[model samples]
Target: MNRVDLLTRSDALARPASIAVDDVSVTYPNGFTAVRDASFELGPGTICALVGVNGSGKSTIFKAIMGFVTPSAGQVRLCGLPVDKAVSQNIVAYVPQSEDVDWNFPVLVEDVVMMGRYGHMNLFRIPSRKDRRKVDEALERVNMSAYRTRQIGELSGGQKKRVFLARALAQEGRIILLDEPFTGIDVTTESAIIDLLRELRDAGHLILVSTHNLGSVPDFCDQVVLLNRTVLAAGPTATTFTQENLERTFGGVLRNFELSGHALHEDDDARSLNVITDDERPLVFYGVKKGKKKPARDKAK
Candidate 1:
């Protein structure tokens, strides 16, 4: 058996990136303004949620970062390098939304993952033993090793997402951009993805996930960028991802359901459990007494 060769993680994603989007704006040829005056900064070792609804300029922001579309104004920097330079260096990996992919296209799961390594390959784009090893390792990391031989279209929705995630991991880019990763997946699969993202964050990768899954934002994300046509708020999850900010960005009230602590058999601490949701699912949080000092910490804390 040939010994496996791999790109050392220290060399691939050696250090965290300081990502900054300062006063950016994107305008299409049709005189359409996707986003205007949007600004947000994210640190390394953090998972930032780009929160918005449909047509809220999430894709525009992503395109700007990847250098796919030049911003009409402002700058996007990755680790102090310009977007184009960063892209040329393969310092970023993007997992586009499922809707952008053709599931009917015939491709093996492993081959799909191998696409991630194309940037690192020579002009011929032939897979070396090291490239093959990276693909295998990435598949194994996403628990998709058993499906390596399966056709991409034959897998479940959640499995397809995992395969793409593995592709990004194989690329070993220091910065990852995920667009609606949890959209069609179940709670279990979503939770698993979040866990993996947390692991990546701890490993010094900077992750930007564009998601409207408000219920799960506080569960794992370290930072939040609230956007509509422009950035409404941006900062730590606990502070910036608040009810008021969400309402302001989404242009609606966050439906809430309250369950008394007594209902859960907590007589001493009879605080009511408030479930905040954007018609997704219940996001659990316990409210403090109006006169008290916010109870030191809550679930999201």
Candidate 2:
């Protein structure tokens, strides 16, 4: 990757200066409320992580922001323009989750990434030299240049994701929203993607990514938005990803295994080893499990 071109790209995104969501809400045809009065703001050069359990409205928020689902109430704005209008101008890019994409479709890696530039180029015009150059640059950014000619079905889960991300980067949007970008990928690929996101943020694009991984938030995100059908919390990771708040959002049943140091409900014994300092008291909660008792720790000790 050319450092000069990357810097130039970043500077261009920074000049734009804004994107925000105002009082957005969504309800399905069956009147099921997926997101209720959701609102947040993201400025240029920052990466925001949106987190929540399954069915917590994270995906719904992304759909609403992208204008795929019309809001039952409120608005989603990008640089003071409606999402649809901003999208038409190629101001934003969206990378949907890998599971959501159909791999059975016949498409090559380069062909998929090149689709990103479709909005900027004429609808019926074949890709020009400049468009192909942009596609190559995007592939290099994601470290997938060599796989340009490869079929999508032949790639691994991580490689397929990189291809989609390359497509988004090729679009050259000022703002990018990725839904669960890290799912099912190896640590190395995940790290590479995170590095790219940081580079993008430093370059001045606003990035919002929804993920289930809480351990990554502190290191990878500038801001964290926790949601469970609503905004449970939204702010810095230190403030929002707290034990108290997490328990409340995820339900008390979903205990933090880090504190207990024992995997939750792993043994049939229903008994877990506890270690506490002299001044500390260890609290153990037991629930009924249908099975035999395992040997105590002393047997192995």
Candidate 3:
């Protein structure tokens, strides 16, 4: 048999990109501003974690980048082209929050993985043999090949997450946007996913994942973008994940228990602590508790 050499398909990867958000802002019909004047650029081969509170526009920004939500003012560009243009070329893949999905939709693992390839297939064309091969490769990469025939709803939470990640892999997207990919996953699966993410970064892929797990940012991400309806801090993890920045982004200490050991004093320092109103409960009770005064003239009776 004549030996045939197989070449890796790096050309299918997305072009080198500097994902730029030029003062982008998103506003809803009700006049609620989700993101305002947010500007940041993420380059190739790096992973960034978007951290913020519930209503802090993390998902809004992701939607803007994916063209689902249009920015009221600025622009979002990938590799020097508009986001929609980049998406049309199949250079972007988004893994939505698992909670947003209806797991009981009755879809098979491989079938869901195939959805990623639909972007590349012509409207009337069926999935080609190459598409099947890509699907197999993606499932294997996430170690979910054994469950390819299983129902997505039957799998564990981590397995479900892996399935979506496999879909992104099958797309061969250059820019991967993961929304809370690690939420509610097992420790083992979280580690596996983090390892896979690192490998992707090493392979020159750009990844931005929205996560509330602040501890893992330093270990698995190259950059951190702290958001509170806008870009509060964006840069290297070490410099950006400081206590002060986190407090500023998250609105003071994340836990009320951190306020322990501080007695309420009438000093200016105590007044500063009062600014943290979002704490679950008061750290220390202030003022004297009023009680019924006993009869002063009881001896007269």
Candidate 4:
């Protein structure tokens, strides 16, 4: 067998890690298409970023992968098993977007985080001291231990995000799917969360995050999956961030920028203004219009 075929077969037969999404697609009951013929494979000990604009099927894909939304076509597998089956076994943890959660539910932060352990505890059994200790460790991982007793409603947006993350940590799953974890948070909180995710990845967990923030993907993710109702691109950031692919994915809204000598310049300016003309192709500039030409210097004759 060829090298590629051998690798594929080996991966298929290998022990499952956290989550694996096959050719999964989702359609609403009203016949509206959300995700179309999408497929991706994620292994343990890796961080993947799902990037796209609004209504680009990022969250829809997440829902299908998590078994929250049934797929109209194809199958979603978790750790080599079907998604529905995996959910019952608590093999996956989902941290949803904060906007979808109601802050007025009147639950303490610690209680909410401790809820993650419910899957492990018997339906009617009380949490043991070990479970409580797991909860404590989870809260500590997200740096939310001090606010454990505070009401969820009293916490700031960043703190609320951390509480949800702590819940995921408490679950102790090998795979985690997060939706917009950095939304509406301060940079400090965002950085802290990123660091925590890295630590989790190091511990052999598979992490998949859907985000609109492209700036952080390169630094934080080992792979990037770009979607727009379909799999526009999927691969390493360096390979998938090409101008041709981005333009096709983002259409006319795609803008490109380049940094040189601590200054950012647009592709249009770099070309029309005659700033630099070499064999190097300029980056595509999106959104911004070409600026007016500067006045010519007076002759010294």
| Candidate of highest TM-score | 1
Cα-based TM-score, every candidate: 0.87, 0.82, 0.82, 0.80
The models' CA-based lDDT, in order, is 0.82, 0.75, 0.78, 0.73
Candidate 1's residue-wise lDDT over 237-260, tens digit each? Answer: 877776567668876555756567
| Candidate 2 C-alpha RMSD relative to the actual structure | 9.0
Q: Which 10 successive residues of model 1 have the least lDDT summed?
A: 292-301
| Candidate 3 C-alpha lDDT tens digits along 1-301 | 1001011264344368458999999999999999999999999889999988788999998998899999999999987889889899887888978888899988999999999999989997489998898888888889999999998899999999999999998887878999988778887998899998888887777899997766566678898899999999999875676556767887643642222123545443432121122332122222222222111111110
Better of 1 and 3 by lDDT: 1
> In model 2, which runs have C-alpha deviations exceeding 4 angstroms?
1-17, 258-301
Error of 4 at 295 (Å): 33
Which pairs of residues have clashing backbones in candidate 4?
255-286
- For candidate 2, what is the TM-score? 0.82
Tens-digit lDDT track for model 2 on 6-28?
A: 44654554446356767888999
Candidate numbers sorted by lDDT from highest down: 1, 3, 2, 4
What's the count of clashing pairs in each model shown?
A: 0, 1, 0, 1
Off by over 4 Å in 1: 1-8, 11-15, 253-274, 289-301
